[model samples]
Target: MGEENMTKTTTKALMAAAAFSVAAPALAETELNFWSWRQEDIAGYEAIIAEFEKTHPDIHIVYTPHEAKAYNTILTTALAGGSGPDIIHTRAYGSLENISSAGYLEPLDGQVDLSLLSKDELLGTTLRSDGKVYAVPFASQTVVVYYNKDIFDAQGITPPETFEEFKAVAAHLKDAGITPLANGTADGWTIEVMSGAFMPNFYGSDFFGQVTSGATDFEDPRYVTALGKMAELAEFMPVGFEGVDYATMKALFTSGAAAMFVGGSWEINGFRDAGLNFDMMPGPSAEAGGERMVATWMDGGYAVNAASPNKEAALEFIRFTATTPFAQMLTDQLNNIPAVDGAVSSDPMLQKVASFHSAATPYIMLVAFRFNKPTGSTLLQTGLQELMTGAKDAATVAKDISDGIKNAE
Candidate 1:
């Protein structure tokens, strides 16, 4: 009896060991690290990751959100140091070009099936000059003049149709003890938005394309005139705007302290949450009878690191994002215009912004045009700041920008 029992127990132990060995490999998890700079997007992405993990139990996503201003430098340093996240949140145009040129990004062209996305979505500013795709498009944005509807109604002011009327509206708002505009120069990027929005209206739609083709320079009279108009608007902005940061500017506009906010469509959700009645329109044309032009471009999207070890897993995550569920979540939850084709957004403001697409032009500085070696977006920012502070005039700032580019060459 003792020998029989011992033999049976040994056989059971061997069978259990073999079963455990067979299952261990299948249970092992593959983790993909995702990096992004949208702190506001953490909750949305977390939800998506949770849903993704439900379907793919063997895969995990580790999301790291960095501060917006320092994200590029941090990402570049990490990529250059030969260690970085598996998936990178890259900006369109110049930033993407810089990273792609360094061979840090994996081409999504053949690796990922982007057939579900529209051509407009796939071939945005993320497309390289060689016609290769470096990143999957996520969202698109257009710069528009967001006006406080309550203030406008109370002041009996309708939307302005011309440059003079725009200035008059600002002056009337200022006289009514309201800050006519909210602008933050401390961060420097918003100035680019201002320039991108106005420069096109003054110089015409083909202006940036011409600049990209070497047919025009930054010192063009139209550019200078745009700066002069911006300087005029600055007079109606909050006192000490030079020290205002982005948060302050947003707060000022959302809190009803300012009558108008000149920014991108990305801010629509935040404004809607503030419960303020607002409407957006393309900024007034610099010409008395000319049409307004909205400055638009692809915001950016996720890209795979060329050196990532978990390339297939990263591609799976990207593919997951392209699915209808995740694409709709991006539109509904984040209020972003999703890159996926027929991804309808329930956001009314975004729809309203999109309605102006017929009159839109590319956001030149950020989207189409590139800077020469020494000068780039930062130079343009500084020049605009100088113009605002009276440290330089329109012509001088324009010349400085042109010289910065030319001298760099």
Candidate 2:
């Protein structure tokens, strides 16, 4: 009860409280590493991360963006070496399957709540054979033919509804001294997007599944016909078309040098900023009465690494992606179709793109079909290039693709 004893006890208690306060911050802080191939998406993702950090002050996100061409190889190397990022941006379908089969991905089944997303947003293509989810689908994209409205209006050409009409339009544009289609085969992957836009019209939705299941192969008469059609279309492109790269192709279309660009919905913002009046249409059907189909699929999204040192923090970030704010930011800023349900954008081009979903089919070779190590896309690209150069016939190109698939297996 003495005054000196009471003063000493109070000072000791205050010192202990100060020590605990200093240690509390250290215990609460957590950092998560996120890896993605989209450098263009950095601003949108950073905005989302900043918002996420507001509610989760203890968590810090280290965003690392890689070049698209080198991302897969680099990510595979890192994962195989057992030192990959905590969060990974993964492509859907075969790419997901390839990584999941290697046991590099954490199954999101019970760890993350995706119920906020609709069934369509769950991306059935990313589901494993056992029905477990390995990733959260973030966006959906469709391969479309983006035509310059000014160019079309100048020539009085309406968008074609049938393959015959498409051919006629191309001829008309060519006769007008305008390049009909802007494509860059030099990048190799552009052929996949180009083929995705056209091949489904010839073979239908079931064709890709049949090829994967061995019910039909690439050497079929239909595939040869598709190759022939591609070659015929190529004739409308500029001379030495293979020399054109992606930038060149985009320039040709946006600068009004070319009448149309064959690409995905992701290019809308770039085209809009280029001051070109443009619109999109679903890929035309092969026959006059054939179905009009658009090549649509779930694009890449985020997944957790099974070997991550910060698994819980990674899961928390992934769960946050399903929230309304994140989805809205994706739509408003990136102009992408968010994978979350009820996430709508006021962008007119996006609205027009979504209008074609009723006629959409899974992107044939990209999502529905499982490509082996070398990929059917690569083979088809090389074959089409050879055909363009007159070094290979449609039948021979088809046979080479069939044999490549078989050999890869």
lDDT of 1 at 166: 90
Whose lDDT is greatest here?
A: 2
Encode model 2's per-residue lDDT on 283-360: one tens digit a residue.
889887788788888887789999998888788777766555566778998888888654668988899888888788
RMSD of 1: 12.7
- TM-score of every model? 0.88, 0.87
CA shift at 157, candidate 1, in angstroms? 2.0
Model 2 earns a TM-score of 0.87
Any idea what lDDT model 2 has?
A: 0.80
In order, the Cα lDDT scores of the candidates are 0.79, 0.80
